[model samples]
Target: MNVLFLGKIQYALYRLVLAETPEAYLLQTHTLPSDLNFMPTLGNGHLGYTVFGDAIFMNGVYNGAGGNSKRARIPNWLNISAVVCDRFGCATDDDELSTTNDTLYEMDLRDGYFRYRKDYKKLGITLEQRSYPHKYFNRALVYEVVASRHATTARSNAPQFLKLSQHPGIASDAFEFVVLNNGSNAKGDYRVIRGRTQVLEFERFQPQPHEIYILFSQSLEEPLQIEWPTWQMEITHRIIICIDREQSVALKDLQDALELNFQDLHQKHIKRWHDFWDNDFSIRIAGNSLELWQIANAGIFYLASSLPSLTTNQKNEPFDGLSPTGLGRGNLEADYQGHSFWDTEIWMLPVVTQFGYDYAKEVLEYRSRKLEAAKYNAYAKGYKGARYPWESAYTGTEVTNPCCPEVAQQEIHISADISFALQKFFAQSADFDWTCDKAWPIAAEVAEFLVSRAACEELKQVCHFLNVMGPDEDHANVDDNVYTNAMAKIALEFAVWAGGMCGNASTELFEKWQQVSNRLLILRDVDLDYHPQHEGYKLNTEVKQADTILLGYPLRFDKSSTHLNDLKYYANATRESGPAMTWSMFAANYLRTSEDWRADEYFERGYKSYVRPEFKVWSETPIGYEGSANFLTGIGGFLQALIFGYGGLDFYRSGNQTTMENSGVLMPPNVEEVEINYIRYGDSKCRWIYKSHSSFMDCGYRKSGKKFEMLQGNKRTLLATNFNVTHRKGDPPIYINLMN
Candidate 1:
């Protein structure tokens, strides 16, 4: 099925017109996917499950070894279906129930949910299946079934109770289910094919319930049924589907588990999602009816969904990292076995850090916690400091698929990318504690590795990183790949700055880093006045996605005419088959330059071919191509095109001061105005608004009593930025500086 399973969400119960929120649109699949597993997905960083909740993948829960190592697909605790019974008899769980197999699959972007409605025209009934991986409850997946019919329609043909049954017949030997005491609950454990133990606990209930009974199944392959004595019912099957990294969670008492209120819990989940889309951490574009708003919202939605909710870690659970597919794929090698790579830091981190503070912190924490493993990897590779793997899974070591040995050995830029991301976060966060405790250590080690890795020509004082692979994975064993060298330079400079800021300053080490970085080869095509992908890289040749152009944007390398030339050169050179993120980077690069027309062209090109029209979810490659779906890398890149490309902002740090510069703001040709509300410094939320020639910016804050304070002044002016941030809507071409 070439169908996409996500898009604008329309509520089945009430069509709400939300003010100041992205207006919801209806997204219908041309045809319902034969397998719900191919539909949209839900994840809370704890686990990722399919839309219908059949296959579930958990973080750090790999079951196998070698290239076959994959996330242990646990027994789905949330998979429950019903046979809507009326005068026509049971009308669900069978195709003949509905005259049309077509299902309306919509997502509630405001509340973070995946919902599909099917009308049984043959049987007088309409069914809505609404499910969400809880945004607040890190381990819970909430599934709702809305079955409705008039009581009069429940004639002699109808049973005494509405039928809502647990999906029967566990076919996989991996699952072992046991109906617990009283049959109201059950305990299920998935035995990893290689004998790993991952458990799932289920809690099923109805909000306005009168009477209910559960049919306990004897074995793993028995159909467990639940029937309620009501013609109309909204049954919510809430499962706390948390699987531990090294062990299984102790099964909770059935009484206490079932006692939880579904209504209250669901309201909390919706509220959290709503808060995310409020004026803070949101984007609005005037005169953009091309579904650009929906795509933007969906991109942010998918990225946020994959991460754990921002809350206290009362359970002290393990948070691995953001995978390429976010919470969309698990137990599948197609999504790279749920392993995190340079994608997290290089592609996704920019957007996450801008909006999600705690989530971005978690991304960095995964690397910090895995520092030992990174160091061990470096040691194994005959280097002096931490060397994060090109592919990292539960072990955090080199889990690079043995099939790609060259990438494992030569993609050394992964280390520098991590360090660069940390500093980027610090620029916006200014969390001295995190800088000292977490960021400093990681940055220091990566800088050390770069120093050891680079070979310098003493006479000319030039440094070359040999036997390296750039982002464009097509080439290998290249020296001083421009992107790699630039990132290494950023990492080294960040280490020097972070050390001084965090009391880890070493005069000798800092000087050495500066010397090496100053000389690192940023190879350029002198004739074309643009960067070459790497040493001996020929111009006008096919390269993979977004390589040399990265220097202009994220790395903030040379901003001279070379940057413009590099943008033009790489745009023609990048292959059509390049990953989905490629065009977005080119778009952002072009948007920042004088040629805004090209930016508009590439902006549409970024997603037109990559996004699945059905759900607006991104694929790693263009449609009809085999690549990861719900591709967060592409989603992140898409957001960058807006946040940086259209918003025209630079958030970076030099020495002790952090700065975010907004210059030459470019609006999409169709957009009259745009407002990007972002989180920066500590928790300050700032808004940048630009339309035509007018712009406004404010770093607003709340004081004691009831006073609200906006930054002293800035109309295309630089405001003295505060480390503690609290944002409110304002104008653009705005500059902010946080002075120590």
Candidate 2:
């Protein structure tokens, strides 16, 4: 869904009112005329006023009162009024409580066209407007009230009831009133009447016989005194007000700021939105509609603007997309709280990463810094090592509140997913050092936790990990959560490899890791040639649909590749599964050694039909859409399916025992294209063969004292960028038969 924003004009009013620290409440009364023909609801073809505030300041935009609040409202003549109040509503006489601060802000915003002009006059403020087609609204007069506060003696010595300060510390405050309307129209006349006296009047200006005239009034400002400390008390209150309008401010010793005439700022906002959409490079799709794209683009833009930059303090930021000012208010307090849950990492990060890798790295670093906390949290629960918080906030503490007090606490192994995410980031960016350092330790800790959690039935040669929740929030705290167990196994294996690669790892660490791996379990049904999600999965007739897609995602077992033929069986069983289940099936179909047409069929159904229409790719789908619709996990899997599934990039252990070879069991060698760049770490040595549909081409390059071979098909040429040719170390040089 497009990020719904509270209407712009109303939001502007709220910001203007809350501009100062001295909190204020703004209220207005609309009198239904006895004639019932006058003062129609302001928004609908009549007049209405709006209040905008920021921190401690407030402003208002005026429209003739006529439109209905419920139905529809778009005024022909627009003006603005403002006030700075103490609470939400508190005004007085002597210092006149009935008066309203007003400004004549004239504008017409319709059909992407707007024109606003204001002039300051002694009698009142005059406004003029002309829209895009040169459609002129002529002129209007608004009698406005000017409120000003002169010097006060309250600062002399604890004096309370003197004239109040305007900005408290600053000089006096001033308010200007103006009358606005069409010079000749009478149907739109209005007045701010306190009892029997009219405080302000709006008069319309026009030239023709058939012209219209509208009238409204402005309130004058009165000086009032507020309680203030006579002298210094080693204290200060700093208020930073962000305004919708652009105005200049002068702060004495303390800081005071203002933004007035902000029409240009609005233009800048729209321009930024446009720039983002312009830069979005999507491969041309066959049947794509511009309207659909606009909706998707707007949603993406809204998501980015609402979410904060991925810096440390800014993680898990939320914006009240549905509120005015689009600020984090209400439940939108999810902003600034830094609750970096799976939503940020799994659902949102892939999009951010595609746009900016640095942002993605910041999120990765945020998670890394929290690793120690995860470990301690796990230990607190009596788990052997780290168990990531199901919901992590700024403190890195588990925010996963259990279903009830009786349960004490919910099992949290989602940290396994966190480790999985780290691995994926490294694989995508080729950041080996990060993987070797930060990721390895945490992965190792999680593996340790899993080892303690795993149980074995030695007679049956079965191992099983249990007591965790899967992505499907509908079910919780179950055994062998396929998602969790698969991730744990992968985390364990990778951690072991990482530790061993360090060479100087302690024997204690290695032995502990071995114990964890040996206890790791996989439940298999030899007759069916497939694995179950968990021990009780078969007994859970209601949950029978969970095994296939849920089991398919982890790709934990080596034999999953051999189980692709059983998909139709799984699909037939899960025919009634929901979209979340369906999306998982699509991913599994893509990952396994399945037929291209069958995989594509599932992919289309899941992506185009099952998931939200708003989710066009792996990037836009949030976790709410799928169980674990996460950062790059799904996207990475999607990419892997494209490359490894269709391209068949599998590397199997060779019979020679010293090397791995492309099995060529899936995709045939002579088909499309394979171009790769390799970066070697440490003393590892390997050879790559690039084969094309036509003929084989071969070459090599050197960089930073390291050599890499470049192999191309005979029909294709090696197009190198920023590289120099070189020979592979200790390899037999071979000649290429070029067409030339």
Candidate 3:
């Protein structure tokens, strides 16, 4: 037996970057956030609240004027979180504390659970609590934890007296705070705060029209005189925060919540989350960087949490809209003051549209609902039809901070961005009825506005959007911005088709749209072989972020020979201080090109420095830079890189092609195999895997109109919505599997 040793066993334990189990969809750490923005957050679409911090913001809820306007923090429902005392010197006991007994916090993105654990080692007791917002509900947050002394603690000889004071309820109001005296009750726990939640506006600090209902309770009666102080004690507590526009409605909803089993509600919450994770065309890499897997989910979780789950039959069906910072940041000057920007329509749309068309529809509807405001904006600006503001808040009016009036004045492309997104939505969903009813109207107005806005030579094909800012904010006013003009063309073209689908357009209108689409200046430099950012654009001229390269992406503009050159050139011009999203666009654009040389490098740069460690919360700028926290804009961009870039799924028709679909999968050489799920709004999901393999180009070339986007591959199988391939090196003429 001693002579028969066959192989060496190093016994080096392999650790997973993220757990493969459901538990892997969790954030657990003992590190405390030096910046509170790093804390985990929860939202029910309408309301955005944090688990451990004080920021609470409602969608479309703004209070103040000019730069002071903010997503005002309403009265804190958890006024005094919790307090526990013992025989020795008293130390405050808070489960929400970032660190306690080496286990500070655990956030399960799966079920939206935020867990907190506190230990009293000397006191021989432990406090564990978990909370989650009913992500599907309009405004429902549930917090629950049960604790009691163990029966095995009978060995204790001495008894101890413990007072747990939970001064729970709303506090800090712009109106009035009156403490109600509940004379006497056998139950040690009690409710203290009451009445309407008055959130004051910034200018006057006066109460707003919205009202919130706050309720708190405990599972056990308070003043427990323990027979033995050393007895293992446990207790259960629950808190439910319900908010509404009317006081009565909030109260009624709270009462209804109390009637149902909290556990059952929690289960429903978990199910809704699965609806997103299960079929939303995400990924599961067999052997690759778990970092992307983790990030994609985190970005989706944060983005989805801030969205109203339309699955529920809640009264407030659709939320206002999503902002750049999402539900994570508000009130603080750091937030976007709950304002919706192009971030919503473009940055956030791809993932939501793939995961839940219902959510995507609601996002478009948010704009349609505010069509009148857009019309007003156009009229005030001396234009026709509609002009969506750069930053829109409650009233859908331009709420672009007064500090930066240039954005509101010159970022006119936001309107076209909306139409572009709507077009993508229609193409992906193929929902004709929605297009006719909702999307058509929006496109019609936007097209009319653009026709009026653009300075086109009458009956000619030369037009320019003058004195407008491109995606690069550094250049405030530029002429014929290629990105803006191309997006406007897409919007105009969408209007043409949307009207045709609805049978509500004139032939002249169709001609006008085509004329503009054909004539809109897509500024190009034949000498440089690249599309200029705008007229008079100079090389390496310090762009703020993604600008001209966008034509190949969200705009779905036909790609030219200069597409790759444009991406490469901008890669140099873009400043290092650019936001997290810029790199993603560069990555996706490169991957789409026939010559995708720097695709891998750009893909890594997309998320490398922007994603924070311990928790994958993204920074508006690279980590350690001064910028907003939980930047969904960047998250959305990163997702686009994964879903469309690495995944190679197209949302818009390309280069005169009529269909709004394309799939060209690619992965880094280091990756062995990666599966991508294609989930368009109304289309059947398409899923396939890409493994490192080779002669893929020959197969794609043989196929008439199909384009294959892999570095190397031979065998091609028509599986689902993709050309599934299994390439073998130097082995066969070609292996093709056509699955019917």
Write down the RMSD of candidate 1 (Cα, Å). 8.1
Model 3, 1-740: lDDT tens per residue?
33212111111111021123264377677876778677666776777776566656666666655445567566544322433444553445453332155756777776666776666544445555676666655566666653334344343421254343333234433224343423133754333333443433332223354443443433222442222235334444456666555545555555566666645555667777777677554566555566666776677788877877666535664467788888646766567777789999888888787766777877888899989888988998899989998987666767788789888899999999999888777666656678788988889999999999999876665998999997888998889988899899888988887777688749898898778788887888999999889999899898999988888876657577788888878898898878988888888888778777687887777788887766678888876679887888999998888767765656443322224233446676356666655454234444555555531221112223333232224533343333444444333323222211
Among all windows of ten consecutive residues in candidate 2, which has the lowest summed lDDT?
65-74
Residue 216 displacement in candidate 2 (angstroms): 27
Q: Candidate 3: what lDDT?
A: 0.66
Ranking by TM-score: 1, 3, 2
For candidate 2, give the lDDT of residue 102.
40
lDDT of 2 by residue, 1-740 (tens): 23223334543464363232110111112222232111111110011112110111111111111110010111212222222233233233223323323423221111112222232222122222312110111011111222222233222332122222222122111112233321221542222211111111112211111111222211122343333233421111111111111111111100111121233323332333333333321111112333222222322433333232222111122221111111111111212122344545444444444434444565566667667776777777777878766544433555333333221243344666666666555544444566677777777787777776677677765566655555544455667765556666666766776677645467687676665566666556677666554556652233333343444433434436435634545565453444332443454455454354566555444344322222221222333332211122233333334334433333211111111112231222222333222212112211223332221212232233432223332332333323332223223222221110
Q: Could you tell me how far off, in angstroms, the CA of residue 495 lies in candidate 3 after the best superposition?
A: 1.1
In model 3, the worst 10-residue window by lDDT is 6-15
Which candidate tops lDDT? Answer: 1
Q: TM-score for every candidate vs. truth?
A: 0.85, 0.49, 0.83
RMSD of 2: 20.6
By lDDT, is 2 or 3 better?
3
How many steric clashes between backbone atoms does each model show? 13, 107, 16
